[model samples]
Target chain A: MSERLHDRTRLRPPAPASIGDRVEDVGSPALLVDLDAFDHNLAQMQGLADAGGVALRPHAKAHKSVAVAQRQIAAGAVGICCQKLSEAYPFAAFGIADIHISNEFVGADKLAMAVELARHVNLSICVDDVRQVAAMASAAEAGGVRITVLPEVDVGHGRCGVNSTEALSRLADAIGEAPSLRFGGLQAYHGGAQHLPVWVQRRQAAQRAAEAVDGYVRHLDARGVSCPVITGGGTGTAEFDCQSGVYTEVQPGTYLFLDGHYGASEWLGQFRPRHSLFLSATVMSTARPGVVVCDVGLKSVAVDSGLPRLWSRDRSGWLRYVAANDEHGVLEVLNGDSQALLGSKLLLVPGHCDPTANLHAQFVCLREGRVVGLWEVDARGLSR
Target chain B: MSERLHDRTRLRPPAPASIGDRVEDVGSPALLVDLDAFDHNLAQMQGLADAGGVALRPHAKAHKSVAVAQRQIAAGAVGICCQKLSEAYPFAAFGIADIHISNEFVGADKLAMAVELARHVNLSICVDDVRQVAAMASAAEAGGVRITVLPEVDVGHGRCGVNSTEALSRLADAIGEAPSLRFGGLQAYHGGAQHLPVWVQRRQAAQRAAEAVDGYVRHLDARGVSCPVITGGGTGTAEFDCQSGVYTEVQPGTYLFLDGHYGASEWLGQFRPRHSLFLSATVMSTARPGVVVCDVGLKSVAVDSGLPRLWSRDRSGWLRYVAANDEHGVLEVLNGDSQALLGSKLLLVPGHCDPTANLHAQFVCLREGRVVGLWEVDARGLSR
Candidate 1:
């Protein structure tokens, strides 16, 4: 391992630049974050949160980086929401100050890890059942941490969380009854709403998710239970969620590096891609008649949602990535025509931004298409 | 980054064992590579490669680890083959001499990187077109290193490589025309045959691939072009390849870590799976009547091929990973029953072993269900 680390210094370092300097000479398979666009995305979300009269708890799951969260907080985000206890552990340790793990945790070990994180930062975790609340409370007591707990209600994504108001109240009551836990609020996140391709579908999904959470909140109010926060909304449906009035915090992450799928969506096309993330791969082989092989493949780009787009140059008529192995991507030229030559460089816009971001260890900051700085992805793969 | 690394180490370490210790942990998702079985598999391939009189250049793309490659080499492999230059870089840097990149090289910067690496090791790269040969020759001249170059011939996989014998000769002649490049052999890998599911289909594919390569070999021989090596074969078709007499080296990587997809194949089930690889995940939430949440998901496991199998447990009828998000996996209890309780650990056999191996940074070596040692996945995520 020590021997491996010896070659680290040999990696081409990012050239120092003035404010407007265009970064060049950075290697391929890099995560390029456009600072200007990233900042604007943050400010826009903060403005939306303010106008909606709701606290903005951005979802770290979309970015999973403390640096991005800090920028969000500086722009007026109340806190950040994380999807996993393992994912939240690094952010809490990095002094993010406030974090809401919006997923229910059942294991005592993970609950202990969460409670330990709460000792360092203000932590709130979600629970859909009383059994989870008991385990969290026990871990919190053992760790000497008073943790805030939220009842996660399934609004549209039928994965986990309480499906009814009764289940929400039972879990909330359990949290309130526990010595080391406090009932935080309702966590009603509609994960499916983030991927709705049309504006009408997104708006309808947000309305349904909002109504579900509103019903839970009204039930809590009837019982004299004061639920403070209702957190959940991704970048795909952030606009619809802002006007919904039911959500107290909108958790959007991909706005920092909007992907090809989001760019193609009718609902999100107007959002203007930040183009912050680009996988710059060199054309490795252009020998086959109309095909090209690239060094980046499934290991470099995440294709779970869809294939990556040719971001820099849309040689749509000539070539495109057809399939990918673990380390090599296969690009077949269309119509027996090939414009991409050997030794050419190409920029790839990953299909799913979040998973692609998770694949890299660091980010190369680019200004006007040149590398200027570098930032560690910080929490690249903290999937517990 | 250091802090995140610290957070990762907080988890329990794997146990160590003596050479003869046969320890088993009662759970699923635990990667159990049976030393005896793995040794047998390696020896079987070694014997076949030796009898066929071919140099065993086992492909590293499947395992992507130095430890596994070392074992393969020690078992009688001449060196190793890689799918990408980046994949070969780490192994080459770590003193794994005689490496052949089974793919092509075209990008000047990437070609230069490959040439620079050749300065420190015995490197042979593949090229399927004249342009790639020119770029490799240029880079090799610039780097002041002489490197072997192979012409990748497409047998049946409709990906990269030359289509005909004339194209193969033309590529070889182009390489011979280069000043700094030496003509190596031919790369005839049939990627599709590795997943054929049936022995007859696999054998038929191998025979077809062999015929295509034999035509090229005969053409090259008539043209007086020395065809020293004809390298290609995967775990699924290695047996047929050895008997075909067309290949001069067999490159099989997946036999070490037999995945769920490979293990479930009617043709491949005969290969024992306990020999290598399993994903260890903890049951995070099981409060839902017929659903349980796991710590691993799309982010942790590769689902490109299919969902992972609940390894070696009778709960196979009761448990199924029905859905997965980026970080959380939802396991559905089919019969509304599960022996897997909250906090119980489960070992999942991944669908595709290669991509899953690329996700992690290290392999936890366990002996007797406890911490033994840690082996770094030295070539992890080396896509470029």
Candidate 2:
């Protein structure tokens, strides 16, 4: 084996950017975080959360940066929520005091990792299955750590969690009995509702999710389980969640780094975030008559939601990103000036923020076309 | 800033795997490379290339592992073609002598990096623009190194490269006149043809690409520019490229690690690689009755092509990977034993191989369900 391949930690470096360099000089195909816009988004979400009297636990799963998470907490987030336990490691290692694995921890290895991580931070995890609860309880007991266990109530996403109040009651009862585990209320996240383009559709989904949380809180209360927290709301449904009157905490992640996918949504149009995440790709090939090819492609940005918007140009209405190869984005002229030079940088607003953020090694945090810092995507590839 | 966040090198690790560990004990959401099948694939591709009298340069953009690239070179591969210049660094640093950037290198930073890299290894880059040729010639001359240049020709993809023979001759004449560059050959890569579902469609596309290459090679030859090599083709079009009698070398990446997307295609069905790349996620939540939520989703696997197929069991046709959130793959039962327990390890054949491989930090190379070695995705995040 090659020695370089054997030891795996040396990541690809801070490409095309020094500490004092201008933004135009920063590397193509970079995950550019407009720190100015990010701060604005942070303040706006915090203000909304505060006005509604809900504690903001900004989901770190969107950006997965220790810096961003810390900033969110500094801006009055009660804590940060991670979608995976392993995803919370770098954050906890960086002294992120409180961390919650908003999603369930399944499997022995992962459960053990969660228990191990609990020793370092104020940790809480969601559980929907009795087996998951049992495994967590065992790991917590073995590790001699008291970890909070949130019983997940399936609040219309229909992906995971307990469906009925009876199921919630059973899981909550199991959690309450565990000496090493504390019952930490309900994990009632309406992920499906978070992306419904229609405002009314999203509101109704949030309402359904809220009702499920309310029904479970009532059920658990009657069964002598004090439900003090109900956490679940994303960038799309945070408004409804904060005003729901039941959720003590709302987890809104993508609001900070809103992308083209969320930007097009009428549901999230009210917040009107200044698209923080941008992919600045170099126009590598201008060989074709009226077309210029960009260096960013599917590998540079996530396309699960949709293609990134041409953020640098006002001709986006008709200037088409026709196709994308592994490392090339083909820009064709439909009506506008598509004659970009061979090395000009074109800003791309990522389609989806979270997965796109996870693809990059570091976020080129910029302010006014100048490099402020390079924030490591500390929890990138931490899917576990 | 936290010291850990700034340095950004020490990655998440449980590296250096021990043999004989059970598959269930492996970490959740891991990129598992079946070594047994991988070796078989190596032999198969070598044999196929040998029979066709064509060289195989397995695309490193698929795995980005120096170990895999070295293995390919050892097993009769000409070299490895990386999609990015920086991506080829770790491989070059690891003593894999020859590397090619299959994609265009734009921007002053990237071109300079490419020239600097040439001092260490045999470097070649593909370009279609005259300005790209001019810049590269200047860089090579200034650096006192000779770098090979492949003038890319658009076959049918229409993503990048020049179309006309007149343009090709112009770029070739520029390379021919340059003191620091060698006109290597044509980069007639039919990226579109590589993923066409039908065998006939792929063959036709390859034929068109071959004719275009022949036209360009003849055009260059008539102008006194010797064209010795022709490189292109991928897993889907490897057979067609090898048999085309025009391509001197074929670049097949995903053949070594076949995924669900390639498996569904009739083109690659003949060479069904033993789903080498597998994602084993824990059944984190099985509380939704018929639904089992695996803690592997868009973050773990690339959904650009399609959802992953349930691989550990034979019921993949019925056990549907219904939905995927940021960190959850919801597996539902259309018909089959979908009652996976909380800790049951379910294997997944990823949708697309390239981006899916890019998503993970390391590949847990497994032999007969036993942990072998941890292969680092060495060149990951080198998008620049």
Most accurate candidate by DockQ: 2
Question: What residue runs in model 2 are displaced by over 4 Å at the alpha carbon?
Answer: A1-14, A267-272, A336-340, B1-17, B267-272, B336-340
Comparing chain B with the reference, what is the TM-score for each candidate? Answer: 0.89, 0.94
Please state the error at residue B155 of candidate 1 in Å: 1.4
Question: What is the DockQ (computed on Cα atoms) for candidate 2?
Answer: 0.52
| Candidate 1 wrong stretches, greater than 4 Å | A1-26, A268-275, B1-37, B268-275, B338-340, B366-371
Per-residue accuracy of model 2 over A44-122 as CA lDDT, tens digit each: 8898899889999999989989888878878899899988877887887777879888887766667677777787788
- Measured over all alpha carbons after superposition, the RMSD of each candidate to the real structure, in angstroms, is 4.1, 2.7
Error in Å for residue B57 of model 2: 1.4
Give the Cα lDDT of each candidate.
Answer: 0.74, 0.82
Clash count for each candidate, listed in order shown: 19, 0
Candidate 1 local Cα displacement, residue B308, angstroms = 1.5
**How close is every model to the real structure, measured as TM-score?**
0.90, 0.95
lDDT of 1: 0.74
DockQ of each: 0.34, 0.52
lDDT of 1 by residue, A1-384 (tens): 112323432433222122343444456666677777777677776777688787888888777776777777878888888877667766766667798887766554466568667767788888776878888888888888899998888887877777777777788788889999988888877888888888788878888889888888999999999888878888877777778888878888887788877877774423444656778776666656777777678888888888887866546556788887776777777765453565566778899888888887767776676655666666666665
